[model samples]
Target: MTVWYPQIDTSKCSGCGECVIACPNHALAVVSARAVMVIPQQCSYCGVCEVICPTSAIELPFLICFASSDNNKDQVS
Candidate 1:
């Protein structure tokens, strides 16, 4: 199973609550004066939080998979 969520960089976070407020899914929150992922399961991976962070604290890591021709041939067999 693949899970997609925003990664909050606590060091860069300004605790401005921008990301938390901008989040449509309400997945992030301010905890201990830092941004934390609260409801990870509710996150829609829409990248809104990453874009709204003024301090560049939020990041959405994506897993890119490339398909090789050889691998495709093996699967077809």
Candidate 2:
């Protein structure tokens, strides 16, 4: 199985729900005035949520393979 990790910048985040709604896979949620990913497996890496985030709060840290344990991919938020 493969997975992508998304980092949320709470400082930049303005409590907007765009990312939560933009996530096509329903992998996002709002928790305690903050955004969270409840289902990362559902992420499709479409970059939809990242694009809609007005504060640039959501970011894809890097592309990762659990079996290899090598992380070189870095994407901007």
Candidate 3:
């Protein structure tokens, strides 16, 4: 399954590191004077980053898929 991730708007971001600090999963970081998704896989798709961002540079999609089961348990053949 696919997962949603945070999208950083560098134009709005001032590299304040607030999102980085607010991230509970340590998925965000400031690199070269810009906030970036250092560990995309570690992100929990939490909105804390978006909320904590003073510039509103962080945008996390509403839906985040964590698990999926393709196994058909009730196949009517």
Candidate 4:
């Protein structure tokens, strides 16, 4: 199964730590003065990090749609 995770853009990131603090799952961390996805499996695709990010460095691709698809698959089985 494909899972959606946040990918950080280093060039745009200011290492503000806003996304790190906002992530409920603690999936993000500061590495080399930039935000990185430290624990990808723990991410719930909730978009909290993306929303909290000030630099727009955190990109969540198809997170909601992928999550909904996973839920539908569970219901069908």
Candidate 5:
């Protein structure tokens, strides 16, 4: 299974810690002047970090899925 989490582009990151502070799940942290995903499992796939990033460094690569009425189960398209 593909895990969904925030991806921080170190090159674009400004070490502003905005994403870290904005994360409601406390999943991101600034380490050595770069933002890192400290707890991937805690991430809720919310776009707060990505939206809060000033440099557009953080990205959440979540798979877009839909539920099928027949099975009432999530289906990845």
Candidate 6:
């Protein structure tokens, strides 16, 4: 399944490109408007983008994780 992440606020952003350059999977890109997360499928949920965002635009989610061997794909958080 593919999930799309939220958009960044260009008004608050300073065009630092920190997220675009620091992305481990190269999923981010800078458009003519501002920086945007182009590919969210590569996100590892490591919160790297949230931590590096200077404008405090990134948000954290409480993910429900399941056991590695559960196989049922069930999760609760």
Best model per TM-score: 1
Worst 10 residues of 1 by lDDT: 68-77
- lDDT string, candidate 3, 1-77, tens digits: 56789899999999999988989999999998899999999998878999999998989867443444447545422
For residue 4, model 2's alpha carbon misses the true position, in angstroms, by 1.9
**Candidate 1 local lDDT, residue 28:** 89
Candidate 1: tens digits of C-alpha lDDT, residues 1-77: 68988888899998999988998999889999999999999999999999989999899999877655885765432
Report residue 12 deviation for candidate 2 (angstroms).
1.4
Error of 5 at 38 (Å): 0.5
Best by lDDT: 1
Tens-digit per-residue lDDT, 1-77, candidate 4: 67678888899999989988998899889998999889888899899988888889888887233334654775532
RMSD of each: 3.1, 7.9, 5.2, 5.0, 2.8, 4.7
lDDT of 2 by residue, 5-74 (tens): 6888888888778999888889888887788888887877788878899989988866633453236336
Comparing 1 and 4 on lDDT, the stronger one: 1
Report how far off residue 74 is in candidate 1 (Å): 11
State the lDDT of candidate 6 residue by residue for 1-77, as single tens digits: 43546456778777778877777888778787467877778777666777798887666555454565555547533
Q: List the residue pairs that clash in candidate 6.
A: none
Which window of ten consecutive residues has the lowest lDDT sum in model 4? Answer: 63-72
Q: What lDDT does the true structure give each of the candidates?
A: 0.89, 0.79, 0.86, 0.84, 0.88, 0.70
Q: How many pairs of residues collide in model 1? A: 0
- Decoy 1 TM-score against native: 0.83
Model 5 per-residue lDDT tens digits across residues 18-75: 9999999998899999999999889988899999899999887767666567664555
Error of 1 at 35 (Å): 0.8
- After superposing candidate 5 on the true structure, give the runs of residues whose Cα lies further than 4 Å from its correct spot: 66-77
